[model samples]
Target: MIQITNLHKSYKTGSNSLHVLKGINFSVKEGELVSIMGSSGSGKSTLLNILGMLDEADTGSYVLDGVTIKNLNEKQAARYRNKFLGFIFQSFNLISYKSALDNVALPLYYQGMARGERMDRAMAYLEKVGLADWSGHLPNQLSGGQKQRVAIARALASDPKVLLADEPTGALDTKTSYEVMDLIQQINDEGRTILVVTHENDIAHMTKRIVNLKDGLIIEDTPVQQVRALENV
Candidate 1:
């Protein structure tokens, strides 16, 4: 459902140009669960940002679910993101002042969903993530795993075409990380497309396919024997 070709990205630092992604190419089909693995300077984040439409490539093409993604005005990009993309970050990215339910409902609010319906939809997603009982709790009131569950609920509330999770389990303990990954696998089992950006080898193995990045290029791409996270959980 996503395609990129010969992608290139560079950033200017003082007088030097730092190339983050060079000649990157990959495609993700619908219903696929993939991981992009890389180190700190490996350009995985840059690739995810381009896919997430949070940033643009300096060159090459990107097409998402049949729509060409280039030169989009801020309004257009935001509309596309709300309509077709869901994001999960390692930091949870929840508003501290908002309750778990409100945080999940935020995207629908931006879509102009009515108060009652958006809330109902958000609650359903929270239920899916096994956090319905904690809907009234604020972020600080929840444990790290609970907060990530809330974040996952918020991501799913939009029913977007693809879920882009950046270091989804980075901040969790081993057991909690596996639990979160188990939840992700369950989502993928239901045929949702997902791309996880992570550097952890164990985390990457949980995905159906792993794409390794080094020095801004895809150095390896292979399908692995999927390590079921549920087994660990």
Candidate 2:
């Protein structure tokens, strides 16, 4: 579903150029759940941004769901991203004043979905995330895990082909983290491609495959079981 080759990205810092991604290469098949594990300043978020089409790569190729994204214009990129990707972030990125349902419905509204249809879809996803009863609660009223569930519902409400999550369980307690991870696993089981970026090894292990990154390059990419087995050797 997603193919990237020799991807490179850099930022200009006055007279010096800071390289954020150095020829990264990987492919994520449709319905596969992949985790990217990296330390701070390791370019995981930069990679996620590129994958989400929020930022363009400086060089190399990226074909997402059969569409090449390197040269897409802003409007074209936005259209592809809106139609093909959903995002969950650690910060819960919800509007403070909006209720859970309203937050979930926002993306559909951006896509010009009819109000009735969007609300229905939002409510359905909220129910899937076990937040249906809390639809009227605003962000501030919900606990961290609850807010994260609302974010997950919001992500799914778009019905996108790929889910890109950045540190999704970072802010929650262990139990809540596991609960959220279980929801992510369930979502992946339903045939959606999930790529999560996290610094936590345990969280990364929850996914089928983990890609370890350091100094802007993938150092190891393996199934989670293999990683654990090797660690125990």
State which candidate has the highest TM-score. 1
Model 2: worst 10 consecutive residues (lDDT sum): 224-233
Superposed Cα deviation of residue 227, candidate 1 (Å) = 0.9
Off by over 4 Å in 2: 226-233
Clashing pairs in 2: none
TM-score of each model, in listed order: 0.99, 0.94
| Candidate models: Cα lDDT each | 0.95, 0.90
Q: Per-residue lDDT of 138-208 in model 1, one digit per residue for the tens?
A: 99999999999999999999899999999999999999999999999999999999999998899999999
lDDT of 1: 0.95
Tens-place lDDT per residue, model 2, 1-233, is 99989999999999999999999999999999999988888889899999999999999999998988878899998889889999999999999999999999999999999999999999999999999999999999999999999999998888899999999988998778888888888888788899999888877887899999899999999976522212322
Per-structure clash totals for the candidates: 0, 0
Give the number of the best model, judged by lDDT. Answer: 1
